[model samples]
Target: MNRSSECITKDSSRLITTELKPPDISLVQEKSWNAAVQMFGSFLLAGFGMVAASLVLDVVQHWPVYEQVSEVYILVPALLGLKGNLEMTLASRLSTHAHLGHLENCLSTITLGNLCLVQCQAILVGFLAAMAAVAMGWIPSGEFDIHHAMLLCASSVLTASVASFVLGVIMIGVIVISKKLNINPDNIATPIAASLGDLTTLALLSWIATLLYRSIGTNILLPAIIIIIGAVLVPVCGYAAWKNKFTKQALDEGWVPVVSAMVISSAGGLILDFTVSNYKGIAVFQLVINGIGGNMAAVHASRLSTTLHTGQLEGPVISATTKLLLLMVVPGQLVFIYTIGYLKAGHTSLTPIFMLIYLSAALLQVFLLLIISHYMVVWMWKLGIDPDNSAIPYLTALGDLLGTALLGVAFHILYAIGDKDSDLGD
Candidate 1:
């Protein structure tokens, strides 16, 4: 009887261990799988969105307004970068709030205040970008006409304001819905912000600039009037955002990143302005590549910000989430590259060498961006600065700069190789 009891006790202990182990492993695997799906879906959606936005940019570049106003080309990268900064930062902020349970109500003071803050910043940055573009354009060409200046300022301010309002609202809905559906907003919000940001801002800038351009000589007052309205709305939005507690800190300390990002992006704009004309399809591919890099970095930043907000200090340097994000880049970019080839097939061919170089450039851009996002978010948190407010702008701007510079190098290399090939053939 004693031997039988001993064997039964051992068997029970073994059963318990076996039962507990599988469930634990299953739970972990389930979580990792869900995260992968969330991130992959977001990236796929963002990739397609950028493909369409790049096409729009290519189309707009041929428009009379874009060609006539050289400053407009200089303004495009800056304005689009600023739009991404504002909306993605807004998304990151909201995602953090959602993860912390502060975003349970869509009409909450926190949500509304954050939205208002983006609007105010958009107004201020929009006008500043226009001024910077004008200066950049002037330094290179030594030509500054008041008519062109007014048109750029009006277009920038109006596009920024309208895009901010629309994108801000969309961000709120996205976050709220994600929360309701038991989805992680951090996984989806930033990419959507980037995806829609390029399309909406470029479309608005194109339409508004064309309309304003038409009225330049006949009614010079139109541009001036739009600028005045944008200026007036700044104070209104500021007042609204300031009355709430959740966003007051951001409003006080957020200008550095946003303004600095705009400057960095303007530098990229200058690069684009110089190199785009010489290259066959740089404009189309540049927007797509830049947006992809920024979107991936923003995803990493947004996820890290949420983790940091939840009080996890010593997290893994390269989490499964980061790996998933980095992995998505290759396939996502391959699709965009070939899509560009198909779209611009008449103008430019996607040779194997060019595609390989472009892919390498994109991979390098995203890999560096991921590393930066990881360190920047942690560093900002240690400094008592909110990563959600600070990291996305800088990361996205850096993405824009890296994407443009690397793309320029790739084209230059291709050109040299082509020249050599022609000589060899001769």
Candidate 2:
């Protein structure tokens, strides 16, 4: 038995050696270091930017439609933050090189084409969702006319889409840098991209709002119409891109992501709008879909593609999977927090912000508990452990806390801000 066990150990060690890819020491030293700095800086800026935008928007919401409102400052972060969770979807995939296969190339045409299509599709989906909110009255009709609302919606789509597109390009570039430096894009891309998207999207959203209010006569009627137009056109544009020769293959290759993202985004808006119209308050109702779907695992497949310089096939899978999983975990958990806060203080906003504040006092609460699980999988991989061996399921179950903690922290922060404002008033 001892001799048999020794033989088995020898075989296992050999298998591990055969599967491992050698590290690129020089690449890690040069390119990776730079990328890390930029990525970290970007994350901090985004976080601060979001806080600023939220405050600005809160102020804008108080103004009268067509009342010469000048709170355009909020536009900055609102644009970036609007699609906070989504921008990472494509950025990570393209950088990771998941396109050709689980193990593939990065600079390939297939990868680029797919990035274009997915980005466009995501934009359309976002538009549809935003519009559906307006259509169903989930997003309160501004104290203005339908035309102004339409304008806001239209501008929102263009701003969000354009910003998302630019960010995708930058994210891919950074991931490529990570790959060139022999670092795994997966490790760096998601967090950085997520933060950037949040910052840039929110900022842009606020800018669009300001611009629309100025040139469109501030009637508020146009924002809704604009949103409807955007919701209609964004997907059509994506479909058109699909028919383009370069992306035709990508379109075929990534049909499911394009279709599904559009559907879900649109559906979510409609559903949330329904809830809002019926309930009648400033509830963080978007969770009915987005929060639930956030935790799905694309797990750097597409990012791996870009890092490996591979194909489009990997990105959408990761995007779709991550979105699905996150939806299930985030919404349900945050809703609980929102309910708790409302019951206690009788005010509401996005639930995630409230939960985040729970962190300030209770370090090991539900939200904080998730951090261990979220990071463990990440930590295990750093130790060269493959999740396929045993940890995947446990890690995923544990990941439920990532969203919970994030939402908790978010909820807590927002609630605290509101409280501060109340105190000032009192």
Candidate 1 least-lDDT 10 residues:
13-22
| Maximum-TM-score candidate | 1
How many angstroms is residue 331 displaced in model 1 relative to the true structure, after the best TM-score fit? Answer: 1.0
Q: Per-residue lDDT for 347 in model 2?
A: 38
Q: Per-residue CA lDDT of candidate 2, range 249-339, in tens? A: 3344333433443344334445444444533332332221122223222232322223223212223322332333333333434444455
Q: Per-residue lDDT of 1-426 in model 1, one digit per residue for the tens?
A: 433222111221111111111111121233766877887788778878877776788789999998999789888867887778888888988887776555543246766787789889998989988998899889988877999999999999999998998998989999889878878888889988888988899999999999998997799899999999988989998988876666776787689998888778768878987777777567777877888888889988887777666555536877777788778878888877777666653244667787788788888888888988899988887787888888888998899889999988887887778832321112
Question: In model 1, which runs have C-alpha deviations exceeding 4 angstroms?
Answer: 1-30, 140-143, 266-283, 345-356, 408-426
| Cα lDDT computed for each candidate against the true fold | 0.79, 0.42
TM-score of each: 0.84, 0.48
Give the distance in Å from residue 25's predicted Cα in candidate 1 to where it truly belongs: 18
Q: How far is candidate 2 from the true structure (C-alpha RMSD, Å)?
A: 13.0
49 Cα displacement, candidate 1 (Å)? 2.2
